[model samples]
Target: MTTNSKYNFKWEDLGDIRLGRPNLGTNTHVAVYRLMQYTMRDVLEKQLGPDKTNLFFIDAGFKAGVEFCKNILDCTLGFDDFGANLADKLLEFGIGVLRFEKADLEKMSFLLTVGEDLDCSGLPYSGVAFCDYDEGFIAGIMHQYTNLNFEVKEIDCWGTGDRTCRFAVELAKS
Candidate 1:
């Protein structure tokens, strides 16, 4: 990775799970993960404005999604296969439940939904939408799979009282 690279997510950053206690392999309660994420976000929001903090979270999530896709997912698979694999991986990793609400392959536009989203499925409503990170995550995954840039935005979030998080993804304009 270059010293000035925007995203320095090397695959090796994720170490072997087998070496991590041998009994507790990537298994943690959702509350624990949320605690860390929310706390970090809180600090960031306090230091930086909400917009900047959200950008940071999105960038982090984009990096994570790219690295995760490269390391864990098979990029060679077709749309259906890739989606199925992603669904299985999300379930296996206790991330969330992924569903496709709309897909237009020709236009490269999609509406994706995640039930029990890791970001804000159960958060108390604050009228403001959360899950900017998830926007970047979904974008990263789509970029990796299609080798095309995408713009992902959260349309509905649990923070806004939605049962599921909904994202609208479209190809980036040239």
Candidate 2:
């Protein structure tokens, strides 16, 4: 399948989309989290339908997180650059240059919920949010993306790996 059709995403006139940084913590992987959010937009929008809902499965624990992040980083930035600290890269990139940290749970989990909501059968262009924590990041991105805000909650999962946690920013969409 074509990338556009496979991911269920479509180009919008919103210009460039960026995610706000989350409060830092040892477990907070902000860059990776943000990357997932934006990428999900593309995935669902392209693979499903412009107005279709989405579902996102997230890694529940730490060990799985490491592997998830590694795989995602390698896929997006390559194995060598994957070793590069994402926080440092974000700080270096400065404002307007968003990064997704692999450990940022609130952001990451929030995205998963929203993605699932989007994947669900519901109102077109409208969606729900579910997460392992509060929906702070979901609201943050909604405000950041469409000037809207939303609520979120956590969803339990049978902790698994084999998923990538790579961070991405909308460079440009064709």
Q: In order, how many clashes per candidate?
A: 0, 32
Off by over 4 Å in 1: 1-7
Candidate 2 residue lDDT tens string, 1-174: 245645532233222344332443233344555567557666866787643423333221222233323332233543235434433332343311223333332442222311112112122222233232212322333233322233333332212221221222221222
lDDT for model 1, on a 0 to 1 scale? 0.87
Q: What is the per-residue lDDT of model 1 for residues 64-156, given as tens digits with 9 covering 90 to 100?
A: 788778878999998989999998988788778999999999999998899998878899988878998888888888888888999998989
TM-score on alpha carbons, each prediction? 0.92, 0.19
The C-alpha lDDT values of all candidates are 0.87, 0.32
